[model samples]
Target: MAKEQTAEKGITSRAEDFAAWYNDVVLKAELADYSPVRGCMVIRPRGYRIWELMQRALDDLFKETGHENAYFPLFIPQSFLAREAEHVEGFSPQLAVVTHGGGKELEEPLVVRPTSETIIYAMLSKWIQSYRDLPVLLNQWANVVRWEMRTRLFLRTTEFLWQEGHTAHATAEEAEAEARTILGVYRRFMEEWMAMPVLTGQKTDAEKFAGAVRTYSCEALMQDNRALQAGTSHFLGQNFARAFGVQFQTAQGDMDYVWSTSWGVSTRLIGGLVMTHGDDVGLVCPPRLAPLQVVVVPIWKSDTDSGSVLEAARRVEDALRAGGIRVNVDDRESMTPGAKYYYWELRGVPVRLEVGPRDVAQGQVVLARRTGGKVPVPVASVLESVKAALEEIQAELLRAARERREANSLRHVNRDQLTEYMEAGGGFAYGGFCGSPECEVEIKERTKATIRVLPDPEFRSDPPPASCAWCGKKAVTEAVWARAY
Candidate 1:
């Protein structure tokens, strides 16, 4: 049996040691744990359950939008990756190569896919023959490896699981429209389902995907005042189609290359959940995605008296489960009720119910919300009360996150204000740029912040405005600068 440690104080008391606290919560909450490998983790049953719920929600959304699931090879030929120039340069540093197979060295090395664009497009060429065969929409859920210099569990691991969607369209306009449609799906999933708000915008030239003509992302601000790119959708604009010779016959009897798009959201979102809503007490999971929304613990003075308390607890659990809520009754005799509370709170369970002799006599159960303190709910109205409480907690978390983002974001016209903003907890800093690479470079050197995104349609600076932040020339467009993750 595993040795039990003494119940520690709540997480709020140790907010200064966030990193250590996070590690503790992950293990204690039974979410995930370190594996034998250096930078890999084993997602325990509890963690996998949460991921399964997320996958089900997303898969349903994808299918509703006319996408089908498919699988691709885990290994891609080295030559395939080199087909796209910009893509090769961007992902080369992260590729894990395989040089030997069947116990012998091979002539051509294979690379574990960092992203599946190369292989997916290679097949797309053969599959697309005419305009009738265009608009191929496919998605795959699988594990990917990206050799990393630093690893942090789900946030930046060497290997992680995610879903990547790739599509082809007959026309450039159609492809662009598909990209935006998927971006909307992602925004909806993150905000409505995950209960985390985001900033949706286009990526700057320097920040776009390696081979994409344009990239759109949903960015969320973490509690640390840093930005996390939650998901991305890219418009390939015939780059992959041209490289792989994917062509379709037009109505006019002319052959033309197909336009492509790809978008993805990875397990890194779990990290966003931990950072955005998590308090000093531990993880604060949004109700929609929480695996076990309500846990009921029965308290008794002795094993003989446990029968009555257990009956009351079970009755309450049945009522909650009937209301379409995920509920669990903790009837373990090995630990005290206080210890169980600590465990579930660390795991971010939204609500907890305690039914004991005294509470049963009063026809009520002691309810404790993870976000707020304890309250009492009548047994008769427990179902409605829990439903309302969970919704309230979800809203409170989103509001708090939005407030932090607003407080940290800054707009500046000069260097002095920019520096002041950075020192006072950095966030999105807006300033004018002349659309020159030279000015972009100067800004990065002066402040460690780069242009994260440029306004679409390119907002030009009006006359009589301040010069560029770096070049001291007439500015072109206002840009958002920040130190990104």
Candidate 2:
């Protein structure tokens, strides 16, 4: 019995197999389930609730930054995409076209949205006829379809939900500023709310968003030491506006194409959350983003004990909820207190309150943390105790993740050392790039590690390398390289 329990605790331990452990946490925790459709999964209620919290927080940030919510069509005319040559070419392989609708063939095929840039700009062109109409900041909460050859639940799917912000400005400088503003928003949300640290920087041209003059990204290092692209901000630089005829009369009375920007973070962030904090047992959700931050379990052996324990449990739940916490009370008669502990811990509830006959009689309840701490607290002070524990847990998760990333990261790495590190299971490496596509391609073909970014000024190394790490050519910039999802 002891050995069996130990096996359960160690099943698919991340040290032995990270991929299996991730799937175990996601499926067994009831976050999501396999779906009937290929390359897609059904996000269960618990999973969706977490996403809802994320949406509410991110939506709040968008609104604070002068963005208004709007709706756009999910289907686009095939000709609309063709207006932008690079956009059409980049997404052609993943395009899902519908030739027949309402049981008849349509005159022209309609393409499900892989992204909204083209369609959104097509509309923006008609709306923005003057400088006053410029700087249109709009966002949409919607589902997008991109026929990915491979999918991993919330990470990548045939269909996924996200908020895409599209903005148009009268000048390139204004549009660029908007893109950077969004980049900061994504970074702040991930680090402050999700308790995940990220490196922000400009993506290499080879990896930048299709049709974007430049793309900025937030790169998070997961527990497995691989990088995840958590979010992106793109500067369109009049590409879409020109292609869609979105021109505005300048304040000086001249007509010119509007500069544009698009930025988004999607359900893939859920996957990033799972990878950043989950442990061998299961998920380790941060308190701020957890769907249920606290769970109260009442222990009773008889009908007499049940009444008192239940009453105390409800009291604790109400107190915590009133204290501005997302909480729930679990009072299932069929399950044991031990079983309830395991279930809630696996689901990553940040804190658990155990109300038993003795604890209730003493006017106290046991406080348990998902990160593995337990103490008895008087009912009078349970709310304060829980709030402190939750705050500590949220901070600790971020600290531990950042420490792990730094420990594995190697700065000023040479080509050989980087290749060896990647083959031995990689982490981030600071190196130099020659700014040549051939150089980037050669390194990827050799090491399977791409440059995650030319890190922003804050993250850039002091006294940057004088030569490229691979070919020893004159270095144009310092880059962060890692094997990524």
- Against the true structure, whose lDDT is highest? 2
Instruction: Please provide, for model 1 over 169-279, each residue's C-alpha lDDT reduced to its tens digit, 9 standing for 90 to 100.
Output: 999999999999998899888877677777777887888999999998887877766677889999999999999999999988999999999999988888777777876
User: Candidate 1: lDDT of 322?
Assistant: 94
> For model 2, which pairs clash?
none
Give a tens-digit lDDT track for model 2, residues 193-277.
Answer: 8999999999999999989999999999998888999999999999999899999899899999999999999999999999999
Per-residue error for 387 in candidate 1, Å, reads 1.5
Q: Which stretches of candidate 1 lie over 4 Å from their true place?
A: 1-18, 302-304, 455-474
RMSD of each: 3.5, 2.2
Q: What is the alpha-carbon lDDT of model 1 when measured against the actual structure?
A: 0.83
Can you give the TM-score per candidate against the true fold? 0.92, 0.97
Q: Where's the lowest-lDDT run of ten residues in candidate 2?
A: 1-10
